[model samples]
Target chain A: MSKQFDNVSVVAKANVYFDGAVTSRTVLFADGSKKTLGIMMPGEYEFGTDSKEIMEIQSGELRVLLPGETEWKEIVGEGEFTVPANSKFKLEVRKVTDYICSYLP
Target chain B: MSKQFDNVSVVAKANVYFDGAVTSRTVLFADGSKKTLGIMMPGEYEFGTDSKEIMEIQSGELRVLLPGETEWKEIVGEGEFTVPANSKFKLEVRKVTDYICSYLP
Candidate 1:
């Protein structure tokens, strides 16, 4: 993938969650799709998604429990996971994580 | 200020600092100017600058001690500060702060 998103609009403010432990900036594409580039500090967080979210982890270590999954999935360095819409997932972020979340339409 | 930056390029990777206590996304303008949108968690941090920087705090509270200054400048809600090139500054972040930092040419 390209290292940079070109010709896009970026919101000035951040979407903060878990008392700033998880923060993201929204990037708006010309095709009306949006993605969030986010950082996750070492912490445990549960998130509910309104849309189908494909999370691409760029770096760091973490374990994820997707909705209705029986086992926890671990990713070190770089990986990805998908979550269904209107579902919740759990994350055990073992290190500082950089991720890009694309909300699929 | 405009709530969003249009027709800009955003690097996919984030700039992580202080073990994830500070993180930022770089936005590249068409005119070669660049800015960083960042989040600062509650903590104390000392930073040194290579070029002149204009820091606009969009939210949260913090106190800053600029280089060659004795007084601590406090900003609650929203405010801004400037740091000269090759100078060092300290910040006491009392709350989670969202900031947009511009590098002056």
Candidate 2:
């Protein structure tokens, strides 16, 4: 379920992964929900998640390799995808990509 | 000169500084104007710019010490400040900060 949230208070921590290829800042809501908004540079990166995540692309393009998929799919310009909990996904960033990841509890 | 541009094409290069305390993705325009949009973690950071920059804060708060200034001033939520070219400024991030830095030519 994709829904828009407003007035999110950001968490003052940054998560840097893959040698700084991707950097994310956490946003905290008053309802205890969490989201991470970040930008990914042009590179191939693999990410693991502890909870189910809905990744919404804000800008640029991403060639993503979802779990159990053999071919990578390109997502661009406000496209979004879901990744299940305890799984991983690989992304080949063709350009500078901006994304928002919402954690579903 | 604070202005907004639309449909910015993002460059694929990421400039990581301060051991990944700050990360920025380059956004290149068609006319060669560039901007970097990124997030700064909660820490004290010093940044030097080659050209004049107008830093627009999107969220959170920042305490900044401009060049030649002895005291740090607090800027919060949608506020902005300008830094002269070839100068440096120090920022104490009291929270996670998202900013868009526009380069003036």
Cα error of candidate 2 at position B69, Å: 11
**Model 1 lDDT per residue over B1-105, tens place:** 559999999999999999999999999999999999999999999999988999999999999999999999999999999999999999999999999999998
- Candidate 1, after superposition: displacement of residue B29 in Å? 0.2
Worst 10 residues of 2 chain A by lDDT: A1-10
Residue-level lDDT for B83 in candidate 1: 98
DockQ of 1: 0.79
Q: Which stretches of candidate 2 lie over 4 Å from their true place?
A: A1-5, B1-105
Instruction: Report lDDT (Cα) of residue A43, candidate 2.
Output: 84
The true-structure Cα RMSD of candidate 1 reads: 1.4
Off by over 4 Å in 1: none
- Kindly report the docking quality category of candidate 2: incorrect
